[model samples]
Target: MKEVLLVGFGAVGALCTLTSKSLSRSGIARVTAVARSNYGIVRGKYSLCLTTRRSRVCNTVASAADQAYDYVVVTTKAVPELRLTPEILSPLLSPEYTNKFAQPTYLLLQNGLNVEKDLYNAIRKLNQGKPSIVCAALYVGTNLAAPNVVVTNDLVNHFSQRESLFLGIYRHEDHTTSANSADETALLQDLGSIFQRGGSAITIVPEIQRVKFAKNFWNLSFATFATLTGYTVPSLFRSPPASKDEQCNPYLYPITAELVQQHSIPAIKTTMKELLNRDPDNSHVPSMLLDARRSQPMEVEVIVGEVHIDMLYALLLVKQNQILGRMMAQ
Candidate 1:
């Protein structure tokens, strides 16, 4: 069985832990969980209920890594305080005496566009290389219901019980490998088994940047608007549309007024189409929006800022094609 080491015991970490338990039950993998809040390892056969399992809790990274792991999954938030730096993660990658672990795979289950890039640079800066890198875009949601317990939102209650949760590797200009590669194919198959065990669906795709950007379009637009307006997703939809007098009021910022006027919403919609080749109708509550409502620091720069540049580029391309009469009329 593959030995898995999970970092960050937050929402995503909790989900991964549960998934690990399912995997362990199937005899496909064994997992040890490490978190800043605590170092707790829970081991059980597949039949164990995640909520009932007691984690072998600890508080330090060094203490958690008494032995090496065959696969290391990092699920911490992108913020530096909770993030695992290369220095902290390096020892787990170490090949030393009494450590049976060899080059272990690294799976990053973080959000935003630069998750892999930041980790890659960090690993490179430390002169560490060996384990294959895999980037994943998690389309599941989890809530920290208790101090050590993470609650998984029933997807059926959220996404109309959609069978497949999208997972893929975000490809940049320099990285040319497709998700169809041997590593990804095998990983996808393994993930498929895990998802199936959880009664969920899995779709593995390459060109993850396109999906990431598409996801960002939904995450940022709602997040920026909601943060500025202090409205929840459901509440925003319930807000009455501004009348002309309210739209033209000089007291309101013109840009803000325009957004409220709904004139720019179509442009935002078009931007989503241009970036992801699809509209935003399928999107659920964006993480940033959730964070904003909870009074947490939002990833404005990472999610919105990074994708905003790309959105503008796409906008420019759209405009240019229209001027040249080369537009793809929808």
Candidate 2:
């Protein structure tokens, strides 16, 4: 059976676990997930069946590395300021693991542009071979309410929209070519098939980085707006404030919304076009905003660093300084 290792078990990671479990049945694959602190909850979520073919969910990367994995799906956020991607993937990049097993294909399921370079370089150095990387732009509306609870915003009746997942094989050297080996292509297709079996809109595209650039463009666009305004992107779309709380305080309402459309929206687009381009579903909050609200380290480097929009980057840095300032005060 093919072996799959799923890293991270938070909001996005939990959803991926469901898909990984689906891939496990039918003698197709066996999954070993590194769930970290959520081990008990994640382990309890799955059934053992008292059989040998049951999947495994462990606490650490070392334990999950007991066997070789054919595919490594990392669903963690790209918070390079706190931890680099290569460091987060230390066990998988270790010479001990690379020397023992065939290099596993990596599937990175997160936002931001050019987040795969560090991991790609690390794997290339260790294996001395061409790396098989699958880059995707995933759009799902799920939030981690607490540690293990993930809430989605899939409304029905005239306002129903399924998630969008665009998968493509990535080569650091070339972006347009999918001339990867037949086996790699089959694996990528199979992965898309498995992810799509649950009704998500999954598309296999040839130009993935360009697609990622497009997705990241929207993310950074709204994210910068949120940081600058101290209001979520959904607020701009609420149309005179819909929520009970928002209805009470409607300052950042339609006029602010106009400013969003006229200024924030167009300026970011022009900046990206000059640079080379790239949120809806209003209930969803941008990840950077969420991180900022929690006083945690935001994903500045991966999301805003590449584009070099100095104004936006400075705003985010100021926000990060505020987070640090709060900690220092405490």
Candidate 3:
């Protein structure tokens, strides 16, 4: 059986754990989860009701790495500025684990640009074989909720009975790119098989980076603006157009049109398009906005700081500096 280590078991991780459970039942995979309550720093709680599961759950990454895991699926937020991903997984990358067991494939479920770089570099430095890294772009809304519980906000599609997942093997290039190696190709298929067995709608893409960059635009624009202005995605679509009266105006801030038209629109056109597509009533709070309000660290370094465009680079850097700088002071 494929031994899997889950680094985080929040909403996204729980949704994925269901699949891990399926893989376990089929004897395709076995899972060990690091299930602490966001290391006691986070306050959001999961809200899912599930049958009592029997998988091994540990309180920390060091304990969870007891066995040589075949796959380490990280669903934690990519906040390298606070704590680098490699630093978090140092125990797994340590000589003790590397010498004892086979190198594990990394399945990164975290959002942001080039989120796999740190872990990738760590494995590369080991000079073992090629690093097997799987990156996913998911279309699911989740909240950081109670321990061991997931707030299942209608993530599963009743029509298909599966959640959408876009998968790709990562290849980091400074200035050039190359084809996936034979081994990497096979590994990608193997991961696809694991998720497929769990009834996930998986689409293996050739250039996952492009898809990731496209997704980042939404964060750079909608997520950033919502975070800056303290509003939710749904506020952009309030009734009868935003007006002077605060009641009719949907935004927490009065400058609804000014926010959308002037800044967020240019950065990305995704938020309004999504609103036009699936009209949902649940609180569509941007994750970044929640982080800011809670006085927690945000993913500005990856989502904002990693933009390739020089034009946006300076702007994002300034914005992230202001946000993180304030946090540091506090």
Candidate 4:
């Protein structure tokens, strides 16, 4: 049985535990979670509730010292300010514990473009052994209902909406290639199977970089607007005002799809033309807006800001190339 260790016991992490447990029933995998703060609450008994209203207690661990795991899944948020190396991975990948645990496969289930690069580099710097890195772009809608309880939406609906877990190997040398090794391919297939058995739809893709870029494109277009305007997706789709008083009210005047198409769509389309695009059926509350509402720092730098920076750099490069072309012609 493959021993799995899950870091970040939030909504995604808990949902993974439930799926991993289902895999355990088939004698394929055994799952354990590393609880950083909620160790006490998670260790004894914690429940996961599905959209169907089914609930079950999940398994968790305080640490990974006792056993070696074959896989480590990270479901943490990808924020620029957070140093995950020391805060999360050090305990497992440190020099002293390197020998104790096997060089496990690292599955990063975080959003944003190039989110896996830093963590992958940090793990490589360990020099213990090369751990196979799998980058997963998750589309699962989940939330923590309580300290020890996680609730997830229906998998059927999630899949119907074309929301799936996209997985691929992380290789810095080439972002366009598929899994280079047979082992990596097998592992990915196995993971896909496990997730499928657990009821989550998953796809192993070749062009993960493009996939990340596409995901970020949507995020940047919708999330940035929602974050800046403090409006949800549904709010953005709210009907326009009929009367002058309604027109004057800020709350009534939503930045609707018509507005976006008229004013923002052209720029958005131009900006994301190269990436070529990649949603949910739920009430369209962007995560950034949720973070802002909760007074938590949004992932502005990693998600929206990074895209802006890349676009600026691309424009600069294009301008430089044009100048050189003109000079050569002259």
Give the clash count for model 1: 6
Alpha-carbon error at 188 in model 2, in Å? 1.7
Pairs in steric clash, model 2: none
Off by over 4 Å in 1: 19-26, 38-58, 81-88, 93-100, 125-131, 148-164, 169-179, 238-296, 309-330
lDDT of each: 0.55, 0.72, 0.69, 0.62
Candidate 3's C-alpha runs over 4 A off are 18-27, 38-54, 155-163, 174-182, 238-282, 308-330
Give a tens-digit lDDT track for model 3, residues 1-330: 788888876667767765343433334666676766653332123212222333566668888767877788998899877788898888898898888887888999888988998898889999898787888877676676545444545532421333367788787773244456676678878887877776666777766787677567756766776776678766755456465654653454657777787887765555445422334344666678877777667787788778765645565456567778888888
- Order candidates by lDDT, high to low: 2, 3, 4, 1
Which residue pairs come into collision in candidate 3? Answer: 45-145, 45-146, 46-145, 46-146, 48-150
Alpha-carbon error at 214 in model 3, in Å?
1.8
By TM-score: ranked, best first: 2, 3, 4, 1
C-alpha root-mean-square deviation, each candidate: 11.8, 6.9, 7.4, 11.6
133-156 in candidate 2: lDDT tens per residue?
899987665667777687766421
Query: Could you tell me how far off, in angstroms, the CA of residue 141 lies in candidate 3 after the best superposition?
Result: 0.8
